[model samples]
Target: MNKWLYRLKHAWAVILGKAKISYVKKGGFSFRDFTYSENEIQFLNSLKIEFLFSEFGEQRVNGGGADFQDKRTRLDPSLTSLRKYFPNAKYTVYSDFDLKIDGVNLIKVNSPVAHPEHPRYGYRTADYFKFLSLTESDADFKCVLDSDMAIVSSDVIALIHLTRKFGFCVPYNDRQLLRQDMIWSQDTQPIEDESLGLGHSYNQSPMTLWKDDERGNVFYKKCAEIMKKDPSRSSLVMWKTAWETGIYPYILPKQWCLCDGNEGLGEEVILHVGHEKIKEYYDQ
Candidate 1:
């Protein structure tokens, strides 16, 4: 199909409040069938879901005059809220230091790149570790949740179901540059200009989901290549590569993972509190 026609069909589906699933043949492989309704929840209860969180035990302090504690201040409460919403779901924490959460598994792993000499050293190391955890974890399906985020809705099962169908999902953030020019169409291709660095648009990775299947394996391998090219900017590279390669299909509905940007948390399931504006909103 022509790219414009594909966009038009998707526009029609959106106008009718219906979901559109498109299959494109590339490298002799075609995407399988998957469907999603606006508010429909399905196939969540039977999935073996696990949540992964990465914290580097840094001493970054917030405006509250206290150390930005990952365990005592952030992860503890975040885990409590997550368990309350998802009682049967398993939890794992990836960190350089040892941690103890009652029912959560702790895995200590070191960063692949020594960041002392990099330009943006110490920036997004935890983000890189989050990607590493995907390869380290044994779960069939994995959802990476930042330590600062809190689960606010019991309907998170809906997100799990969406991930199972879509293969991967990321929350929509208010960053205009990240969202613009990111639509996946037949003609969409990855940017090869190294000078572009992070490229024009990408997913907000504060909270994301991944499956352990073939698609997930390919996605992670690409991410690893990006990290090898530039360790300090792995997060940006992952999104850029995904968009350019058209490997990851779609972004989850905004209601699934809400960020602390311009968008209000009107029916959002997960509340991401990593931004300064959100911290101010919660008076933290």
Candidate 2:
């Protein structure tokens, strides 16, 4: 069976702002503060399901002073809150140390790439590839999420059913180009493809549903291999190849994910909290 899972890139503040996406702002984060409000608590209690959260770790915030371990700890509330709804649900927090939430295991990716290198290190896609490696052996259906994401109770069931129907589900909207000042290139081919339904758009937020099967592992390995070959150019090559070839058919778009960006303030449907802005969203 095909897996249905959502994925997102945890970008930095500068990157997030430049991408024209909005995010939550609060104090810096600590594991103790991730507590959900009573309303938030009640909402999570309503769902009775299990899901995996593949949160990208602190590497995304290179320049920030926020503590990585604290951010990781802060996620416990969301994990605990999720357990309230998904009793059988387990969480696998990917990091250097193995931790557990409820009965869920926290998988660790001690790969060399996880270490600090240069200013331009740990590309968001690279972290995703590493996280995927950790899940390659699991047997349950997998649902990957960016750490900054919060889902509505209604979307829970719809996502499950939708994934079952379509081999994959992605939230797509008109892909708007970054401002002229932020434009990385004058590439119009992709712009046209986005218009023609031959292109896809997303930060891969709570990109959901992955079957605990070989196909999932195979797909993960394929991505890993591509990055291992040339980590720097893999993203560009992937985009280039996809554009040159008709690859959008492989990705489904029946229920395009919604981004706040569509609403004027540019809410990133998946709220990509940048490193600099971590303090803005969570109490420091």
Candidate 3:
């Protein structure tokens, strides 16, 4: 809360106000993602935006395991789309071993948590890098994007707008009903605060938009504490922590930021390549 920092935030607030960004909400629904003025892109590009991605198991490529067999194939296209939105933005990849992707900065860190015995990919333990990068990032706006996805026009700007609007942005969970409190609690809900809200989103996709500010730091610090004890067994941690911290995210509608579990992927969406099952969804 330094005076200069506070003033700087205030100054940005005023500049944003002057930017005259208009939100053209799809279907006129308040909760849905909106299309912004094209002029806003320049201003958005001027900000310090960074895209975070992780490839924990390079060996997954050679394996027959479906969990991440084709994940590496998705990285390049995703990067190309990300670069389109934020032409001068930073791209960071958190990996377990040495990796070189053109125009990407790498942080070779091993998985901090071991996967619990699960027949499935044990995704909870595998996504620790998603938490690690977002928590440690110093960008003005940080986006946690799955390597399998591509960014369409204005999607990046929309995410940043939501983070600034509601303190954070996460895609709406289509299967939110499956997120029983007992189910999540049995899995060891990280920051236990009974007074806070629960199940605002249960998508468990690592995709997110975070602004580097006071509330953002609190959210990251809470995740850091969870990492020490829990260490990203699932994206449920991100969804739950956002609510518990009172930084209830703006739900980027089902059509935009589309993923697996979100069915009926017609030709009316913004982002479609998110889950390992995305290929099947595309085939259908």
Compared to the true structure, candidate 1 yields what TM-score?
Answer: 0.67
lDDT by residue (31-62, candidate 3, tens digit) is: 22233344565677668888887776555441
**Tens-digit per-residue lDDT, 19-83, candidate 1:** 65554333343322223344332344555668888777545433213234544644754677677
Q: List where candidate 3 sits over 4 angstroms from the true fold.
A: 1-38, 61-74, 114-122, 178-198, 204-206, 231-235, 239-247, 261-270, 274-284
lDDT ranking of the models: 1, 3, 2
For each candidate in turn, the TM-score is 0.67, 0.52, 0.66
Residue 160 in model 2: shift from native, Å? 1.3
Between 1 and 2, whose lDDT is larger? 1
* Backbone atom clashes (below 3 Å) for every candidate: 1, 32, 1
Ranking by TM-score, best first? Answer: 1, 3, 2
Q: CA lDDT of each candidate? A: 0.57, 0.39, 0.56
- Segments of candidate 2 deviating more than 4 angstroms: 1-50, 54-72, 76-81, 98-102, 112-116, 124-126, 130-137, 170-198, 212-218, 232-260, 263-284
Deviation in Å, model 1, residue 103 alpha carbon: 1.7
